[model samples]
Structure formats: structure tokens, C-alpha cells
Target: MTRPTPAPKPSAPTGTSAAHVPLRWVGPLRISGNVAVTETEVPLATYESPLWPSVNRGAQISRTVDAGIRTTLVDERMTRSVLVEADTAETAYAAARAVHDRLDELRAITRATSRFAELLAVRHEITGPLLFLRFEFSTGDASGHNMATLAADALLGHLLAQVPGIRYGSISANYCTDKKATAINGILGRGKNVTAEILIPEAVVAARLHTTAARIARLNVHKNLVGTLLAGGIRSANAHYANMLLAFYLATGQDAANIVEGSQGITLAEDRDGDLYFSCTLPNLIVGTVGNGKGLDFVQENLTALGCREDRPVGDNARRLAVLAAATVLCGELSLLAAQTNPGELMKAHTRLERLTGARDAR
Candidate 1:
């Protein structure tokens, strides 16, 4: 696989509104790296800072909740169209599927590496005689937006070279739906559908967060569910899953814009025996162990500190990173939910954290 380009730099530093202060290390949330779970406060300090070199600080509320990560690598699809000059749209779609089935039969002859893209399904759109072939692949680990594209190219070449009566209309068809939200991807899922769940006890919610599970459930029902439905939202119905995802992405080397899909998540809660079973599912989490700015000094150091810089099976590392990201999202989600349980807590925490950090830096 080709190396992914570097991640962009963090936006211009803010005066007091900056979400993070340079050299501020946020939490050893889990028993990560050399830090124990008890050392939840600033376990991994920002690496290679000029001023706050020795001191370590954590993403305050982020350190409280526990998160668990799980990764899934399913087929992400893209389109390679074939020109089927047929009498009608019905015939055009049939023509594309027939070619796909033929290719499926000859898989034994066409495939070289197991990594060679396998066609999962064939979908088509009919514009009179023009037929668009949207092919799906069971791409592993690496978000195969580009992988599927390359594989589609090769597959199209093979079809044209070998298959008779398979005329080509185009290869660069957008049906594969790269980097955008589509209903198909939402249902089938694209990239790593990483889910992070935490069962917060009633006692902990009451004592630490000043909230009740019943209230949490009610809030989600009205705000996330009904509110979003009323507003005509698509797919997701959650509270600020993107906040944590974006913060983590900026720290790590990832395509920040992918938060578009990453943010398309569902935050669900159940009052399980008085405890809140909170989970966030980011179906379109596109992250990797390698690629992007993984080569950067700061990003590399952060990954190492997060214990994500390790050798594992081919897709294991990337999946691990996905889970970690999901876990982080859960942490922030839980914390913010707790804060909102009591009015003004969110801004108050901001006042204490951001304003104080800004004040400290100015000093």
C-alpha cells in the first residue's frame, strides 16, 4: 500500500479558546503504555515541548470513564461502470450483474494475492443504455477507499481484456461513494465500525456526575432521538461524538475530515438495572496504525505513548487504533453527559480548565 500523506497541522493557536495547550498530556485512561490505571492524571505528557517540558496534564474529564474497544473490517464498496448499450434501464442493470457473476466464476483464474479485491456485491444504476457497476470489496484494516479504487481499476482492466461483450462506459464512477455519506454505506458500514461501550454504575453516576440513569435515558430519548428526528437528521442521533473524535484525530495522524463520517454515530443508553449502559458506535471510523503523519515526530511519539505503536498482525494494529479511538470517544461522551446532568457544569469545567490553562501559560 502507498504511504498516506501527512496530516495537517493543528489550527492557529487560540488565546483562551484553544481546546488543548501544547505539551498537555491527557490521561492514561486505560492501563496504557508505562502508566498504570491508577495514574489516570497526565500519564503521557506532551512529547518534545520547549516550555512545559517536564510537567504533564491530562484531558481532565476524559480520564474518568472507562472504555472498551472492538474492531470490524468489512467490505467497503466503490463503482467501476460498464457501458451496456441496452434497450432499457432494466436490461442495463442486468448486463452489469451478469458481468460481475462471470468475474466471480473466474476468480480462481484472476486472483493473485488473497489481498486481491474480491467482489462482495454488484449494484447498478440505469441511465437508459449507460450502466454503472458499483462493486463492493471486503477490504481489511486499511480504509480501502483508495484500495477499492485501485482494485476496481485492475478488475475493470481484466474484465475488458478477457470478457467478451463487456463494453466500458467509465471507470471513475462515483457510486463507490468515496469520502461521503451514503445510505448504503450507513446500512452495510464502511471502514472500521469501532464501538466503545461502558456500563456506568448508578452509584458512580450519582456520586461523581450528579446524574441518574433514568434522566440520562430520558435525555437521549428527547434530545438525540426525537430532537434529531424532528430536525431531519441522517443516520446518527448522538451528543458530540465528533468532539472527542476530532480531538483525538488532531493528536494522532489521521484525515481530520473523516470526522464527517466518524461523527455519523449513534449514542445509545439503556437503564440496565439502574446502571447506564452507554455505547457509541462510529461505523465510519477511518484510522490506521500507519500512513498520514505517522512519520511526524509529535504524532509518532503520541502513538507510542498511547501504546498504539506496536507490531501486530497485518490489520490488527489498525483495528486496535480504531478501538482506541472509539474508547476515547466514549470517555469524552460520558464525561460531557455527566457534566450536562448539572446545568453550567460544562462551561464551568471549561472555565476551570481552558481559562486556567490559558492563565497559566500567560504567567
Candidate 2:
């Protein structure tokens, strides 16, 4: 009998965090009494399947991640936007840039509170009398929509008081491109971009995944690249980066819709010394560690179990979580590509995990 073992904790999160925010509706908020906590051991994996137990709250994590993987923190940026009806495009642009510059000069780059906002870019567009400004900032640990909105309102107030001849339009002009896949997000780069790469020995690949490293490399090029290009995909071509991202996102209570940006990623594999060198780059990973549902019993327990509660230095916790997310995505990509190289492994696993097991559990 082949029983699954505890999943390897591949650089899991650490630290403790708790909160008592009152969810007030035009009144004082109250606590829910779900003080979720994880003491020391990380919950990298419990045991899980791709389907059925889709909630994945307590589903098992995988143990098949590459052991010799190297992850890099490439970039991290957050954005907020507003629309302004101004006399001219240049006028609105100057108004927004002035505030952004002022914020920059203060070097208010944050390291505390999940709501820290440090200006990154003040983007602008104009169509007739409508001038749109997408105020980009690094909003620490929170996925930052609320924080960014708050900052946008304040900036609009600032523009009204100082910029002259500019009136408010909308706090979120959709021009900011939140929860959408856009060339702007790809070009300017929103969220954290983390890259995970590894060299899998040929023997190991053959033994476990039943495919040679060289073959996996070629498969990556032909399938993910050429096939994806023919399909007219944008900024992505992989087996299932979103599979892992969605599982993790749901487990951690992140804004699920942001998976739109989260799925805007690339997977690369190369032939090297009879070993396959592979990497996955995830951009626009709008994830948070402190707010949203991080305080809930299931979400917080998962975050804490994953050791994702480092709340100091503002964005550090979020950055760490992004790296972990990227790494996990890489694991899933590698596993699925290996399965693709085989004939029936993918379907067999699905039938067994999703159908047979799921049905049996229902009984």
C-alpha cells in the first residue's frame, strides 16, 4: 500500500498574528470569536486532489515540489486609481503627479500596518474632459484595494483643494485595471512578481514522473509556447498555475477574483546537462496577509499554519506569501507537465481522486 506522507514544508511562513476588528455597519463593530492560530509547525500540505474537495480548507498539500528549487523576489508594486473631470489632460496629470512626487519625497515607504501606502506611480489618461489617474502605491500586507481606495479619496480631496479646476469623477475608474488582465499591469507590473526555478535530474524525472528531463523541456516549448501562441494567449502559457493559486487563495481567503491577475504568469523549462531547468513567473499576485478574511478561523488558521503571519515591516509578510505562492504554482506546473508527458496518469489520478474517492466519501 502506498500511503501519502506529510508534505515537505518548502520555506513555509512563520510568526503569530491576531486581530479584533469590528465589522461595523454604520455602528460599532464586534468580534467573531474565531481566534485562529498556528503555533510552530507549518502546514505546507495535508493531502488533497485537484477537484471534489474543492474548498481545500483542510485538504492535503502536495509533497512533490522540487527539493532543489531556488525562488527570487523580482518585483512588488500595488496600484489605486481615480477619475477626474479637469480642464485639460496636462492639468490633471500635473495635479496627480505633484501629489505622487510629494508622497515620494517624504519617502513614506511603509514597513508596518497592513495598510501602509507608499507612492509608486501616478498614471494618467485623457478622453475629452475626462482625465483618469491611476495612483500606484505599495500597500504593504493587505491586497490593498480598500487601502488604495482610501488613499485615492484623500488624493482626490488634495486635488480638489490644491490642483484647481479638477472635480471628482470616480474613486475607482476601472482604468486602474483592478481585477483585470491588462497590458498596463503587464507593462507597469502590478503586485509581486516571484520566480521559482529548479534543475531536476534526468534519473529522478524518469523515476518519479516517467519522463526524461529533455523531453519535458521540449514539451514545454512545443506545448506551452507554440501551442499557446497559436491559441492567442496573453502573458501566460502553463499547465495549471491557477490551479495551485486558486487552491491556495481559497485556503487563505484572498480575493478570489484577483486570480485574474494571478493567472497572468509564465512557465519556462529548458534542457540542461540531462537535467531540466524550469521557472515560473507570477505577476499581479494581489494577495494580503492581515486583512480581508485573514482573521477568520479557517483562513487565519491556514495562514498561521503556513506561517504567513509576519506582520512587521508592513509589506514583508505579503512579499513572503507571494514568494510561497509562486513556488507552489511552480510545483503544480511541474507536476502537471510531467503528467502530460505520460498517457493516463492525469486522468487516472482525477478519476481516483475526484470520482472514486469523492463518491466513496459521499457514502
Candidate 3:
């Protein structure tokens, strides 16, 4: 994957002298990396009810209760999409065709097949094996975590059954990282669960580019960037940002625990237009509607406000929020950089704001 161009140096702030400090400069400026800025919005589309034959009303009620808590407890059902990538565009197309054919044949099977109510779409292509497939499945009122797993497992089983010479070693399932095994052990004892894997060259490209971008951004840090900022401050900022976003995710019927892995965001900044040009990315964001949890009083309201209903077009609102978060952090960092070079002005402004607002502390 090709790396993004290096950022230009930022011009020194003008007009305002260090004497005209701002109250906001008192707190440590938190900045996210480039990986946190890129986002793609997806709309939740209609799917054939996979729950009807699989779940009884009583079980469904239990699922509703679980969904209310932003948990992923529910009956297992299948929902899947296939992605294929290769060295060349032609090769990739050929692989996709093969996978698509295989999926169709699987749908024809007795216990393994069912027609998808929603047609699948190719989300985006980054580089290498970096392709994303979003299956808009309706998991009733709870998060469809189990459903996604079942679908992936069944699909893998079919693929293995039909394709010879492919071993488990060739496949690596991940929502966030390989270390999920450790996190799962800490949270839910060793329980075997279903997982999803999509093969896409674009995914590989995206990952490589993202990693490179992060390295480039870190290199831009200088002596002035330290002292004022704590050691490992960037990581701390990311963690703080993740936690804040998790609160919103929980409040909105998202499986907040997934944030433990999916909460990662990347940021990249360069000098542009006399300001910083920045980008961020977040992946593995699993959200659901028409689940048990979404029926909660506040969740339903928030989803409505966000236009996230079962019938609406897949939206990019979530991605946009992530980008906004990156921008906020970049602004904070710039403010902090200025403050470190000239603290007296910032201190005075912070003091004034505290007195005026009756605030007791200033970071």
C-alpha cells in the first residue's frame, strides 16, 4: 500500500500574543492520530427475519431484556457476506465471482441456505487484503453478535467442506486484534464462539497505510511537544477518547464492550491552510437496530434522532462523529502546543474563566 504524503509544517499562530491566553489552554490538549479520522457510514437495511423459525416468543423476550443492557446475548442465527481479493484487479474479480457462486450454492442447501433479504454491497477498498463486507442483519431487539458468528461459522464450514487443501492456518478471524483471546478470557471464561472473516486486498492495504501514517505523525513530535505533554500522553488521550465514545455507544444500544477492541481511532495531521489538516479512522464498529436493547426509552429516542431505524438508508453519521472527534483533538493539541511555549497568558485566562464560571479546577 502507498503511504500518504508527509504533512507541511504549521505556520506560527499570529494576531494573538501569548498575553491573550485562553482558558481552554489549561487542560492537557488531547490529540488523536490519523487512524482515527477516516470513517465510512453504513445504513441499516432490511433483512429477512432470521429469528422467526429459530426463536420462540419467550426466548425473544429474554433477548429483548438483554438488548436493553447493550449486551450480545441472544439465540444464534446466520447472516453473512463473502469477500475475495487477489494480486490483480482481474484476479480479485475472479475470486469474488468464485466466492459469490459458492455462497449461492450454499444458500441452496437444506440446513445451510436462506435467501438474503438485503443485497450485499462492497463497502470500500483500502489496499492489500483490506476489504470490508457489512451484513445488515436484523437480530431482533438485541445485538446480533451471535448471529454474525453463526453466519461466519456456517459459511466457513461450507467453504472448507467444498474447497480442498485449505487449512485453518490460512484463516485468521478478527474484529480488532489477535489478542482478543486474552480479553475474552478475562471477561467471559474460555468459551468457543463463532467469528467472521472477510478476505479483501483492500483491507491489507488499509492496515499498512494506517500503520505507516501513524508512524509519520509520531515522528513530527519535537522537544516542544514534550514536557508540556506527558510521556505516553498520546496513548492516554486515545484511551480517554475511547471511553467517552463508549459512553455514547452504550447509551445508544451499542455493545459497549466491543469498544474494548473496536474503540481504536487513528489520527494524521499536516500543516494546511495555516492550520492542521487531519484524518482519523475507527474499525470494527458493530451496531444494531430492532434488537431488544434498542427498545429502551432513551436508546429508541437517540436512534430516532440519529435517523438510525430499521428502514432508513445506511447512514454515515457514526463515521462523521469519529472524524469530528479527531478534529476536536487536533484543535486541542494545537492549543496545548501554543500554551507550552507561552504559559503565563494561558494561566491568566484560565484563572479568569474559573472565577467567572465558579469552576474550582484548571488542568
Candidate number with greatest lDDT? 2
Ranking by lDDT: 2, 1, 3
lDDT of each: 0.59, 0.64, 0.33
Q: Write model 1 residue lDDT over 158-190, tens digit each, in one string.
A: 666764544666666655555566665566566
TM-score of predicted structure 1: 0.75
Residue 125 error, candidate 1, Å:
4.2
Better of 2 and 3 by lDDT: 2
The lDDT of model 1 is 0.59
Candidate 3, position 86, lDDT: 43
TM-score of each: 0.75, 0.77, 0.39
Candidate 1 lDDT trough over 10 residues, lowest sum: 50-59
Please report, as a residue range, the 10-residue window in candidate 3 with the lowest summed lDDT. Answer: 45-54
The residue ranges of model 1 lying beyond 4 angstroms of the native Cα positions read 1-24, 31-87, 103-121, 125-130, 138-141, 160-172
Residues 240-309 of candidate 2 have per-residue lDDT tens digits of 6766676557666687788887887888988788777778878678788977777666577666655578
In order of TM-score, best first, we have 2, 1, 3
